[model samples]
Target: MGFRNFRFQIVVRVLLLVATVFVFFKIGFNATLVSTQIFVGLLISGQTVALIVFMERTTNRLIKFLNTIKYDDFTEVFTSRGEGEKFDELYKSYNEVIKKFKDIRSEKEATTHYFQAVVQHIGIGILTFKKSGEVQLMNNAAKCLLQVPRLEQIEHLRAVSPQLVEQLLTLPAGQSAVLKLPHGKERVPVSLYAVDLVLRGEDFRLVSIQNIQRELEDKEMEAWQNLIRVLTHEIMNSVTPIASLAGSVAADVQDYLEAQPGTQICLEREETEDMGLALQTIEKRSQGLVRFVNDFRSLARVPTPKKQLFSVEEMLKQLQLLFQEEVAHENILFIVNCRPASLTVLADRELLEQVLINLVRNAIHALADQPNKTLQLEAFQDEDSRTVLQVSDNGTGISEEAQEQIFLPFYTTKPTGSGIGLSLSKQIMRLHKGSLSVSSELSKGTTFTLRF
Candidate 1:
């Protein structure tokens, strides 16, 4: 009904202004024309103002739409229907786009909240910080462990441990380190690892810290218990025989002296031989116990490794040569596999050899009575890009219970097992900053992995 066409409205406003000007000029300087001229002038001014307002309708709506977006006020709908079909469609499009953006922003915010909750609820203490010592996030565990109610900056940990802040900042991704923090009378050991991330156009480091004090204590206690059990068993075996034999020997001597009736002891030949045999038996048992104790000592006092880089193939070849005779005599199929041919590792050559030799010997023993016996020694890179030396044997596999205590000192399944081999191997691996682990199942096989 009004000037619905935008271009037509502009043309009509111009025509009205032109007509008003012509009428005023044609009737200039006359008293009769004054009222008419004033009326026309007022009409022209009114039309001009109206036309300006009409033209700015779309601009005004656009300004309002932009303000809504700037303020993140998406509740208002940019809807128009009456001005024209084109204006109606334009407004509808704006509304649709804004609604989509609102939905996306809502979804993004929800996802952010979900991850935030996960990070907070994890058991490991997590700290996310910027390069400038500004802490972006610190989980509840982190706050408790650091003994602070809140963390705003990494430097706040300086009081906890003078080097903690510096270590965390400089820690490389994928590598882990341990830090000791003073906790009252004792020091707490915290294992730390970090990952690098870029968020919101800025770099941040997410570090995880956990106290390993409880874990170390548990391991220590278990080791002591195992040691005590072994010591008690060995000592009892030796002491029991000695006690019984000493009493028998004393009675035998007293009987001989009493029967002599001359204040002199004279033992018969048979009695002398019997007592000497008993003494020899006691001496032998005592020596055996001494050797047993020495073995335990050796297991406990493993020498520190003198590490050197050596080729895996060369080591395997040497082992094969050293044990070739035994393998042949036992009719065992011994295999050595080294992937990439030139694989090498940095470790003490002698210690590593001892570990491998112990594992191989154990495997050989297990396969002694088994048919189709096979032992494989392999060296390759594992999934984590770490070098692994594995010894696998298809022999009588270990029971689940035995496997649990296999690495414990003085714990063994074999009858005459000194029980020090596997434990010593594990200690050697630890000294090399490596790991020794075994996987076995009854009737399937056992695999011993040495990871570096």
Candidate 2:
């Protein structure tokens, strides 16, 4: 209807102009009506100008509306200025279209921010980089794990760890690698997982970094604990009966020997003595087996820590005092150092002390063969602000192969080692929501770190 009205107005103006021109031409030859002809000519001229202006007005408004959209200037609001019903509708349509575009842009921005926030705050570290090693996005978790304020290129991580950079670059999609990177004085185990991404025809890689040191420790401890639980349960069940039977038999034999006075029981004195010795040996071996099983049982039965805040300085002091005699006898130097002298820890004091004692014992043993034996118990706060206690020794360090299995139940390097002490100590720390780790270099020294 608006189009029809526009066409009708255009046709009426054209017809009026044509009719006025024809009349002017007819009157052009009459000399006495020159003034009237002039006035008629002026009317025709005015109508022609008005028709052109009216047509161009709509065209100009259309151009202006297109420009507004082209430039994404949604702020422009088209309004009718007494231009008639057609332009009023036209202006309304332009305003509605602009409003829709504005809403779409606003929604797009909001969705973008929502996703950005989710990527930033997720616990796992996320990193997106191009095929050229240009880092595009790195989240807060990534920064914290890498110990970097910002990473612009993957190559920059070489300073942090060259192996990490290599793994990040060459790690295939759908696979993961656990990289042990040094963070301050501690070594952190990070699990890196990668997937290929293509955005806007550009290839990218999205890698997720997660500090799995604690998780790995927990899992390893769990596996050992489970194995020990099963073994100890089965061994105790089997060994308890044997031990009891051996003792009973030995007692019965002794009672018979004591009660009978030369009651000929098919035995010479030498034979009787041999039989008694055999029974005593059996009883002693069975009892020793029972004791060994009981020691391993402790690994599975680590009690929940009755935690309390205590001074680390005092704890180290107690350890030093406890081992004073042994250290002096072995001609070893025992050193205790706690920075600030007021560092404290929230833990079960007794349980923690037990762990310390085990580590210190191991350290002392490691230092035994060294000419200049030095045992040190150091306590301080780590970079992450967690309490750390280290027992170090300047002794014959543990072999690399042994270090890997040291925490496993029944894996001991020493000839007389029961191997339950380290395992039990690790379990105790786990119960307290802490970790026990060992680092050693053969012939250099050994350090056992307890992180809480």
Per-candidate TM vs. native? 0.78, 0.50
How big is the positional error of residue 253 in model 2, measured in Å on the Cα after superposition?
Answer: 12
lDDT of 2 by residue, 38-90 (tens): 89989988998999898898899899889888998888888877666876888
- Candidate 1, residue 421: CA error in Å? 0.9
What is the C-alpha local distance difference test score of each model? 0.88, 0.87
Question: lDDT score, residue 217, model 2?
Answer: 95
Those runs of model 1 whose alpha carbons end farther than 4 Å from true positions after fitting are 1-52, 73-124, 139-144, 147-162, 172-176, 184-186, 254-261, 266-268
Which candidate should be chosen as best, given TM-score against the real structure?
1
Candidate 1 shows a clash count of 0
Tens digits of per-residue lDDT for model 1, 1-452: 55665557678888988888888788787897888889888987898888788868888888988887888888878766456667788889879878987998899999999998998898889999998989989988888778888988888788888788878988888789998877677789989998998888999898999998889889899877877887798689789988899889989878777778796677678878999999998898888888888997798789989988989999999999999999999999999999979899999999999999999999999998888989999999988889999999999999998988898877789988888899999989988889999999888789999999
Clashing pairs in 2: none
Pick out the ten consecutive residues of candidate 2 with the lowest summed lDDT.
Answer: 1-10
